[model samples]
Target: MAKQALGPIRRSFAPWDDPEAKPLIHFRGVTKRYGDFTAVDGIDLPIYEREFHALLGPSGCGKTTLMRMLAGFEEPTEGDVLLDGASLKGVPPYRRPVNMMFQSYALFPHMSVEKNVAFGLKQDGMAKSEIADRVAEMLTLVRLQDFAKRKPHQLSGGQRQRVALARSLAKKPRVLLLDEPLGALDKKLREATQFELTDLQVDLGMTFLIVTHDQEEAMTVADRIAVMDQGVIRQVATPAEIYEQPASRYVADFIGDINILEGRLEKGANGISRLVVPEDGLVVETDQPVESDAQNAWYAIRPEKLRVSLDQPADIAVNTVSGEIWDIAYLGDVSIYHVKLDNGTIMRATTANTTRLVERPISWDDRVWLTWDRNAGVVLTS
Candidate 1:
C-alpha cells in the first residue's frame, strides 16, 4: 500500500531551531563506564517534546547504553538525566514516566493480546473497567482490535510487534523508547512498517526515541538522527543535512553510499573551491566551503548525484571523469554502475530504470563519462 507524506505539520516542526524552546529530555554530560571500558562517553543532548529522535550507529557504539540510561535501567557514571526540568536520579524504571519496547517484542507466551496490553495498567492498580477501556483503545490504535483474543504465539511476527507497540503505548508514557523495534521483520515488511510507524507517531502526537543501527530506518522515521561511533556522537542533524552536508567524513560514509576522495583544496571565488585529487586523477568542485585553514581535505558525493553517460562531458575541467563500466547491478527500480576510472578508482553511479531493461542504453565494459554539478558535492576538511 502507498503511504501519505507527513505534510506541513511535521515538515514545519523544528522546535530545536527556536532559542526559547525548552527541551523535554536533557542529557547533561552523561557518561557510562563499565570497569575498564567506557560505554557512553561524556555527552550532552536534548530531545524536544513530540519529536521523533533516532540514535543511530553500529554495535557497541553506546546508542543502546545511552537509551538504557534514559530508561533508568542503568545509572549514568557521571552527569544526570533530566525529564521535564526534573532530575531522574534514583528513579526506578517502572516508577519513571517512560516506556521501553525492546527489539524482541517480549510478549508473554500464554497471555492474549488484550491481557498483555492491560498488564501494565493492572500492575499500577488501575480499575478493571479502565484497563478494559484502555486495552480496547490501544487495540484500535494499532488496528488489532479483531485479534485481541489471540495469543502471542498465534500471531504473526508483524502482528506480535504491533501488540508490543500497543502494550508500550497503553500506559501513555511521556516519551517512548524503542530499541531496534523493527529488526526482526523481513526487509519488505520492515520497509512498509516504517511508514506505518511514522503515521502512528504522528497520530498520537507523542515523543518517540528510537535506537537503531539501520541507517535507512533512521533516515525514514526520525525527525533528527544522532550518529554515534565509539560511544561518541559524531553528528546530529536532519536526514537531508546529515546526507548532503555531513560534519565529518565518518558521518558522510556511515549514513549512505558516498564516494569520498582525498584531495588538496584550492580556494576559488564566490565560496566555490576545487579539490585536486591527484591519486584519483580527478578535480571536484564544491560550492559550499566552510572556513577551514587546512589545505588537505576530502571531497564527498553520493552515487545518485553522479550522471553516467557514454559521450564525454562538455566541460572536462572539473566534476568530470572518464571511466569504464566494471560492473552493473540491476536493483529493479534502479541500476548501480561501478565505473573504474583511468586511475583505477571505482566510482559508483546510480541511474533510475524508468524504461524496460531491454531498452537500456549502457551496458557492461562500456566506456562512460561521470559528471556532476559544482554544487553536487561537499568539501570536508576534517
Candidate 2:
C-alpha cells in the first residue's frame, strides 16, 4: 500500500507574539447543575495558549460536565467561562471559537471521509474553493488523503478517529476540546495515537483541553493535569509533580499504585520527625518537619521505590521489615512480589526481570527483607 503524504505545512495565523497573552480558557467559580444534582462546582482554572491540559478523574467526577460548559454545550449555573478574555456566558457552541471531538467519533457512515471533514466548513458557509483546500489540507495532515473516498464503514477504528480529529481541526479553532479521544482504540493503537495527538497540537499551536478518565493516557499526553473528584479540583500540576508529590491520600491513590501506611509522627532532638507504623513496628524518617500535632499521620510509598532481598543490608539505617513472599507475578518487563509480614500485613515489591529463567535469586515462600531509603517515602498529613 502506498503511504499517504502530508501536504505542505501551512503557517498558523495563531497569535504567539503577544507578551501579555491572556489565557485561552478561564473558569471563575464556574458551577453547573442538572436540577437537583450538581455536576460541576465552583471550578477556578486557567488554560494558557497552546498548552495541552487534561481534566482527569473517575466516573461521576464532573470532568465531562466541565468540558461541556467550556464548549458552550452546557451553561454554567453560577459563574463565568471566558475565552481569550471574552465572556462565553451566552455564546452558543457554533459561535464559539472552539470545536469538540466527541468520544463516539460522530462520523456519518454514508458520507465519504472528505465530505465528513468538509461538513463543518460547509456549515460555516465557506466558499467551495476554500472548503476544498481546507479539507484537502486536513486530510493530508491526518495522513488520510488516500482514504478520502472511503466511507466511515470502510475505515478502521483508528482511521475513523483521525477523520474526526481532522474534522475538528478543519475550522482552525482557537481551542480544541477532546472527550476521551482514544477510548475506542486498543491499548497499542491508543499509545501510538497519543504521540500523534501531542505532535499535532504542537504543530498547530492550538490550546487542547482533554477530558479523560484514563490516568496513564492523561499523563502521557498532557503538559499538565487537573485531578478532579466530587465536582472539585484536587490538584493541578505537571505529570511528574502530581505522581511524585501527591497532595492528599485520594490524589496519591488515584494517580497510580501506592502503599499507604497509617502511622504517628515522633519528634526527635535533631528537629526531624520519624513515622512509627504501629501495625508493622516500622520507623520511617522524613525530611519534612512535624509542625502539627504528631498524633496521626500517614506515609505513602511507591512499590517501585522499595527494594527486596533475601538478606538484610547491614549498612543501611532506614525502614526495613522482614516478610515471607506470598505471591509472585511475572509481567515480562518486571516481576511483582507480594510479601506478607509477621503481622499479616502484605507489602508489594516490584523487581526488574533481567533474566529469562523461571527460577531466580528469590522465589515465592522465601524469607525476604524489604527496605527503602528514608527520603523515598512521603508523609501525608491528611
Candidate 3:
C-alpha cells in the first residue's frame, strides 16, 4: 500500500480559540526534582485535542524533562499530570495511552521495515493477521509501503526515520511524543519531512507533542509552541505570535536576530509610542502604546523592517537615522547593510535582492539614511 495524495485541507484547526475546548493533556503545577536539583518547576499548561504542540528551548532547559513526565517515563515530584481527565500518577510507560518516538530513529539494522513496524503490535499479543494488517496500514500512512522489505542499512536516512515513525504510529496511541524526531536527517530532508509529518498528523487527527531545540523546526510544524528556559515556561503562543510579539528580551533574542537599542519613552499622543534614544540621537515612533509609569524601555527592531537608502526620504517624521554604511553582506537572496551612526551605534538593515542587476545600490562606506514605519515594529517594554 502507498499513501494517496490527500485533497486540499478543507479547514484549518484552531482549538485554542474556542472557549470550551478542553485539554487532552494537562500539567497541573507539575514539578520534577532529582536530589537537590529541580528540572521542571511548577508548570501549569494544557494541550488541546489534535493540537501539534512543541516544547522548544535550548539544551538543558528542561523541555525534555517536561515531555518525559507526560510520557510516563518520569513521575512528578510535586504536582500531578492528567491525560483526558484521568490522573496519570503511578502509571507505567508501557500501560499509558501514549507513544514516544526517539531522536535516533532507533531502527533495527537487521530487521526489515515491515518487521520493525510490526514489532510493537506483536509485543502487544496481537494476532498475526492483525499485526500484519496494522503494519501495512502504518507503512502506507508513512509512504513506506514499497520499502517494507528493505533493511535499515539499505534505506535512506529519511526512509529509516519514516520506518521509526511507522512503528510508533502502529499502536495508534492517543498522543504521540516525539523527542527530536528529525535530529539526524540532513537539512533538505529534514525540511521535507517536516511538511510530511504535519500533513500526516492532520490526516490521522493525532495529537503530537514534540520536543526540539531547533527554533525553525518548532515554528514550522507546530500549531502552538511552548518556549521553556531554566525549568520555567517563558512564553507559549502560536508561531507567528511568538515571532512577532515576543514577551521578553530573552525571547526576542532567542527566536531570531534582533537589534536592541536603549531608549526611554516620552509623553506622546494616544496609541503612539514616542521613544528617545539620547545615546544614538534617535527619535522613534511606534504603533504600540506606552504607559506613563513604565521606564527603562528598549526598542527591538528586526533588520528587515529598516529601509536604507543613499538619500534622506521626505517622510522623516515616522522614524529616521543617518549613518555611514560600515559593511555589507550579500547573501544572494538578501543583502544586509551595517550602518554606523555618529554616536558609535551600529544598526543593520536588510534589503531583498529583488532586481536582476544592481543599479547604483548603496555600498560600503557610503552615506545612507535608515527609515522605518511607525507600525513596522512594536514597542517592547521588557
lDDT of 2 by residue, 1-382 (tens): 2322322222232232345767788899999889899889999988888788999999999999999998888999999999878899999998988999999999988899999999989999999999999999999999899999999999999999999999999999889999999999999999999988877887776889999999999998888899999999999888887999998899999998888888898877666679888876778887766777568898898888889989978966768888899999888898899999878888888988777876677887999989887778788887
Which has the greatest TM-score?
A: 1
Each model's lDDT comes to 0.91, 0.87, 0.86
TM-scores for the candidates: 0.95, 0.92, 0.94
How many pairs collide in each candidate, listed in order? 0, 0, 0
Looking at model 1, the pairs that clash are none
Question: Comparing 1 and 2 by lDDT, which wins?
Answer: 1
lDDT at 194 for candidate 2? 95
Candidate 1 yields a Cα-based lDDT of: 0.91
What root-mean-square deviation over C-alphas does model 3 reach? 2.3
Off by over 4 Å in 2: 1-21, 269-271
Error of 1 at 145 (Å): 1.8
User: By the TM-score metric, which is better: model 2 or model 3?
Assistant: 3
Q: Highest lDDT: give the candidate number.
A: 1
List of clashing residue pairs for candidate 3: none
